[model samples]
Target: MAETIEEIASRVRELRELSKVTAEEMAEYLKVPLETYCCYEEGKTDIPASKLFEIGQRLDVDMNLLLTGEEARMRIFTVTRKGEGVEVERRRQYRYQNLAGKFLSKKAEFFTVTIDPMKEKPTAYSHPGQEFDYVLEGSLKFYIHDHEIILDEGDSILFDSSYRHAMEAKNGRPAKMLVVVI
Candidate 1:
């Protein structure tokens, strides 16, 4: 069964309690206001994918634990069948399939991202890592820092993800790509 946002929120609250960490501490660490963090933990708001990843790292757990309620322990190899990845709807126009969510102690996070064309200005998101994107279908206009670049199928890019970045589907069509964040 697919876990709902409420379920994930409950796990977040439960895990933090078990770890003896206060919500305020988590909010401070995430650099968000206490109210905003509380909303996410209470299921009043959908938690962003980056924020969820940060939470998992801080709790010393794999992203699988946060998404599926199962601990990932495989150190040898893990295979995710096509269309079998954990799905996350992080934002309105973005759908993410976690390609390696069940791999434990991962040095990088893999995802297949499907993005719809924007209706307004795309929101910029940034994290403290590097990112790689390979377009698999359609076209994407990627904005990094202050520049915009158009990428088509089979095109790939590697960039410092610490700077603000965003993407929008081009030609009035959706874009799909493989994303690796490290």
Candidate 2:
């Protein structure tokens, strides 16, 4: 089926409800009026690209996901830092296959993400937690719902992971990012 603005808006509204965040609160987060925010969610008004990007950032969702409703989940493998060189833990694999959901463990969560230049757009994941991401190399386009931000080498963004969000490599360049969810 062809995608429609209303569909995107409705999905976003559903995600917001799932997050247990109210429209007024989201509006506060976006620094927009409640009515305007409602209009975006209701699809009564066209969302500006930049504003949509802001909503994505505030909601912690991937702009593309919000726009296309496509799945971007994946299985990521990485080595534990305390180990010699690399030790794989089958249980600790990072799966972006679904919503990260609530953190079961109080301990810190970490994931090593690698983006290939030729790969399709990455999926968006959101949960109720805090996150810190540091770029190891190259550049990435970070989308928290409609919001898009670029991070170069050594750049980082720390924010609540509860927002719907996703990330992608810019210019088809390979990028590596270390994500810590707490």
Candidate 3:
């Protein structure tokens, strides 16, 4: 089942409180404006997965805990069968499936992200680390900092994620991509 933004926001708030971290502190940690972070905590704005992952790191919790309200327990390899990964519905135009949600102490987070065609521009986000994306189906226009690159099926890119980046489908069709965040 797809978790609602409100449910995720509530969990974020709960986790923050349980960690004894204040909203102001979280905003500082995330390097975002207090009001913007407040909007995320209040469910007024959708929290990007990258930002949520950062929050999980800052709070010392598994990212799955924020996405699925479940902690990863498997310390070794975990096998996720087809269509069995955890689905995260953070935006109307995108679907994120956590492929390694059951793995513990993961060095990199893996997800299969599907971007639906939209007339409205997608928002760019950046955090400290590296990101890799491989086009699995359809075409995608990747916006990294000031450069724009187009990728078709079987194409891939890996780069520093500290620079603002975002991707959207091309030709008004949905694009499926495998995303790995480190």
lDDT, candidate 3, residue 161?
A: 96
Q: Rank the candidates by TM-score, best first.
A: 3, 1, 2
Worst 10 residues of 2 by lDDT: 89-98
**Model 1, 1-182: lDDT tens per residue?**
35689989999999989988899999988778999999999999988888888888788777788888888877888899998998888888889998987778899889999999987878888776799999999999999999999999999999998788999999999999999988
TM-score of 1: 0.95
Give lDDT tens digits, candidate 2, residues 8-124: 689779878987899999888766689988988898865543354456566667544555565334335333232222111111111111122122221444556656554556556
* Candidate 1 deviant stretches above 4 angstroms: none
Of candidate 3, the 10-residue stretch with the lowest lDDT total is 85-94
- The list of candidate 2 runs beyond 4 A from truth reads 1-106, 118-120
Native-to-model Cα distance after best TM-score fit, residue 86 in candidate 3, in Å = 1.3
What lDDT does each candidate get? Answer: 0.89, 0.61, 0.92
* lDDT preference between candidates 1 and 2, better one: 1
lDDT of 3 by residue, 57-141 (tens): 9999988899889889998689999898988876777799999989999999999999999898888889879999999999999
Return the top candidate by lDDT. 3
